[model samples]
Target: MTDLARVRAAAERLQGHVRRTPLLSSPFLDEIAGRRVLVKAECLQHTGSFKFRGAWAALTALDQGIGSRGVLAYSSGNHAQGVALAARMLGLPAVVVMPADAPRLKIDNTRALGAEVVLYDRATEDRDAIGAALAEARGLTLVPPFDHPEVIAGQGSTGLEIAEQAAERGVTAADVIVCCGGGGFASGIALALEGSGLRVRTAEPAGFDDMARSLASGQVERNAALSGSICDAIVTPQPGKLTLPILQRLAGPGLVVTDDEALRAVALAFQRLKVVAEPGGAVALAAVLFRPAEIKGDTVICTLSGGNVDAEVFQRALQRQAVND
Candidate 1:
């Protein structure tokens, strides 16, 4: 149900709230990818991720009476912090259900942002059920991570920026690669670029590539494993009902990248672009850097979706760059 109009409306709502992340490029990165590469440093966005854009849009779009009662959401990490901080800013109480295995930094950050955190087992438990129960018990409106129309519209605002920024740089046509989980971000961008020359493509971690598989098979598919990948920020079980349909109609074939590739990308982004990228946030950059065969055209733009990484994980990623050097 999300379209360009709704995305533009969301951008209007987000005018003063969210940061318009910059589009960055480095000659070293360009040489590595064998093409001109532009990285959208959304890792610098509020809460250290692009999730803030959607969180703000979704929470603000809610009915005043309903939102004041509180809001609830479930996410591995990025979305949790986004919703938590947005709720705090709006003077609304928030309860976030996060997987027990989510990065410690994200869990602690959510709590520090003044939201109550609930931990759940991602494999043996259903986060949706837990969130729903909590929401019903507390009279809280649920702000979904990616499935809702408002959230998609909020995320679509990223695409609007990409299109305009690319134009300023004289990039009339290129591939826009997005790090996709439930397809909300990618689908939103696709909708925003509906008639633009920039084509949207999705990138995912290898084992948790439900979006890639779904795009390949032309049907929604689920990932077999849930808690193994380091890209927890983007490890969703399946594409959302609303997101999948939009992607199926608008997006190009999805690309899949490995954990090592993701980590390497995190390191490289830090070294080359001086931007810190968490594993999930680096997948799109990984696709552009390591999976060059799957990409096309003379130019590519990708998002560094988040920077909410644990110290140890970030150290590991950085060491890879040191080892290579």
Candidate 2:
């Protein structure tokens, strides 16, 4: 389990840098679930994703000598932009190795943030191997997207903010739900909720439910046939080694929703809350409204993790919603 003290220190370290995103009450969700639902709008976060918290934390945690070295990382999308922007903020050079098939907009945004982009084939190339070779050649530090302790600690800052925001509003015992990919965001949030009198659960798409299957089997299981989903961000084949134990201890049974459900949730967020939630970001909200039994509290906090979807994807979600209506 991640130490709460270290997470608190990270929160302190990131005081003025990361946004303390709003905890919004959702009447629509409350009506459907018969309970109060709060959405943590991390879609408004830097880089339009909560990944910035971890990237910033990891970069800042380095020693003075280490700071002189550039940073290198492998990511599908969000983390790539996050590390790129964070490195720029800290005046550190960054090189991000991303899968060639990742969203083009994300790739363009990352490059615009002043990071060198190296694209590889996710199906045939080992991005980790390529990133490691580059790191070694350039004497740069390798920042793994979701497996490092500092990265986990940094992501924990989101949970800390949620807790504080809830307390300030005189609420307690919230069931905090977050979308799980490699389990970084969920594990970090659970770490922050350790002593806050709240429960934590993870949500994911049905076809990409690696963490759910792993939890049920009592061991990590890699999905051999990775299927494409609207929620592209949470489509990891397996959970991170460091994150699994933390989640096993802190999280309840993982909840899974369909691609259509996730897309609908994204549309609902736009229509009801006037917030644009990417499919991955809307998964938590989908769980709160669709999987009430898995959630444990009258007060709930769902992490809207990112809002980086392409315009075409967003429009498709809207069209699907319209057709259903």
Q: Which candidate should be chosen as best, given lDDT against the real structure?
A: 1
Give a tens-digit lDDT track for model 1, residues 1-325.
7899999999999998899899999999999999999999999999999999899999999999999999998775778788998999999999988889977776887899999999999789998889889988999998888999999999999999999999999998999999999988899899999999998999999999999899899987999998699998899899999999998888899999999999999999988999889999999999999999888899999988999888889999989778877
TM-score: model 1 vs. ground truth: 0.95
Per-residue CA lDDT of candidate 2, range 9-52, in tens?
77887889998988876687688767888899989999899999
Q: For model 2, what is the error of residue 92's alpha carbon versus the real structure, in angstroms, after optimal superposition?
A: 0.5
Q: Model 1: residues >4 Å from true position, as ranges? A: 99-104, 119-129
Q: Give residue 165's error in model 2 in angstroms.
A: 1.0
Clash pairs (backbone) in predicted model 1:
none
Off by over 4 Å in 2: 121-125
Query: What does candidate 1 score in Cα RMSD to the true structure?
Result: 1.8
Q: Model 2's lDDT to the true fold?
A: 0.86
